[model samples]
Target: MWLPNKNEKKKSIASIANDFIGDGEAIFCDSSTTCMHLVPYLIKKQNLIIITNGLHIATSLSERSDAKIYICGGHIYNSSGSVLGSSASEFISNFRADIAFISCEGISKNGIYMSNDEQAQIKEKIITQARETILLCDSSKVNKESYYKLCGYNNIDTIITDKKPEKNSFLVNTDIELLYPVE
Candidate 1:
């Protein structure tokens, strides 16, 4: 697994929130640690509602007064601290949002990819159901492929990362907007 360094992960997620989301937009954010870092920014918006599936998000958003949180029911993936399964996929398929912020274990020129099959299916559903999809990842994940393909590069509206893509050859032709942290 290509795990991002702490600062890189935070920068990646913050860039995703700044670029794809607008004021008053309801967004569905995955319960990944990277996604959690972006939650404070989303909560600052008076009209943003966050729909998520993990207990961590619920606890994190509990003290926030500006954002409203909704939990989705599903089986938990203990290793990742995420919810996934058929029921989770169905719930994701039925739910629609202005944007969905997703984080994957890996991604390649071929497509958005994931490490787990059930989580991959849920990610695919989120991509289909949301009007716009923003992928949050770090430099380490770029150009690195995974087993299961969630969707192709065309499916995502934007990709946010901490490192500059110029250093990674494969990121050149994808046509996805790339966001880097401000120095």
Candidate 2:
């Protein structure tokens, strides 16, 4: 299967974003390039409080957007411009959000997984507290396995991808709602 280019993968983010963000919902946006793409969709919302560890997500929005933002407090992972560590996880857990938008390094029978355990812990905390969870990943990540499990397919309410999996793929058999770009 041919992997989608960066732009193809990015186009799907908007479609997924529109599905997740309601006017006044509180959301936890993960520190993934996929989640960062939500910035555009949020520009017109009102009474939104975007809680995130992704510095880019928090910083990218224009002050004119009217969305209130909170940066997760913890050790900053400079390379990725994300906040992590125990402190961050604890802080994020204190609030129960309406939804969480996350991504992982891989997806398989075991669960969706990410490379960093600290981020994984934080994502896990958010999932347990969120009313619903939306996972954002391109098709290339399907069937791949990563070091740390973020959450299981059972935990996901929806998944948006840029590629279509075969009939026998794990995603096809799941109850999770699948959203793909209109093309």
Candidate 2 lDDT, 1-183, residue by residue in tens: 111235657667656667668899998888887776777787778889888888778877645478888888898886787799899888887888898888889998678988889888888988887899988888889889888878778899998888677778878888899877665
Please identify model 2 stretches exceeding 4 Å from their true place: 1-6
TM value for model 1: 0.87
Which run of 10 residues does model 2 get worst, by summed lDDT? 1-10
The segments of candidate 1 whose C-alpha lies over 4 angstroms from its true place after superposition are 1-8
User: For residues 84-173, what per-residue lDDT tens digits would candidate 1 score against the true structure?
Assistant: 778777776767899988888887767778877887777787788888888888777877777888888888888788766675466667
Report the number of the highest-TM-score candidate: 2
lDDT of 1: 0.74
Find the number of clashing residue pairs for candidate 2. 0
| Candidate 2: residue 83 lDDT (0-100) | 90
Clashes of each: 0, 0
lDDT of 2: 0.80
